[model samples]
Target: MLTPIPLLIIPLAIYNIIAFLTPGVAWTSGLAEIAMMSGVRWTLTVSDVFLALCLFVLLFEVMKATRISSRSIVDHILSLLLFVCALIEFLMVPQAGTSPFALLVAIMLLDVIIGFSVSIRVAQRDVALTAAPDQ
Candidate 1:
């Protein structure tokens, strides 16, 4: 039951909650600054952190795609739907117009593409193996 649900949706909901509930928050504002040994200061902003979280979720999404099952098909469908919804919001919604949100949408799209592609490839391999003659 839980397998059909897209994991990336969690980050999407979190982004929406942050955007709509706290309008004053800035994505570009630095969340942390780390100084390197070479005297370089690296600033990690809200946008960077959000995008990193999305990417982490994406890694899990790809891993989940490796399993061949009925639930995985449903998962791919839901992931595609999620990508469409996110794309729509990125294009038409003011709050979602930021670079971080745009990248999130792109990551969702990648998730859908990778999910479907991997499923098909794995399914093909399984079919081929099953059809092979006995030694």
Candidate 2:
């Protein structure tokens, strides 16, 4: 079973690769390259799609992390490690160091932090509940 935290990488990697390979066209990539509808021009870029994906994964991570269990701890820890990797990659790799990608990395970092905090809160609540005196 794959956790949401690690799943964050797929979108990030896809976005970075597409962005890097494309020669700064200032337009969309893949099938949805360009669009014209309702007298408005729009384009769907890799970063745009992947950012949404990362956000969706963040929601799942938050839900799973807030669950009261030991695995939640491991999930958040792995998330933090992945966050560090993303941060380093964004900082050191020119190809992947775009503003949009950096923003995504920031969002992923937030997921790690929130996941750990939420897990801790949930774990504390579980301990308190189990330790409560029964009649």
Local distance difference test values of all predictions, in order: 0.92, 0.72
| Cα error of candidate 2 at position 102, Å | 0.7
lDDT of 1 by residue, 9-91 (tens): 99999999999999999998999999999999999999999999999999999999998788898999999999999999999
Per candidate, the number of residue pairs that clash is: 0, 0
Off by over 4 Å in 2: 1-5, 20-43, 129-135
Give the winner by lDDT: 1
Query: What RMSD does each model have against the real structure?
Result: 3.1, 4.3
Winner by TM-score: 1
> For model 2, where is the 10-residue window of minimal lDDT?
25-34
Residue pairs clashing, model 1: none
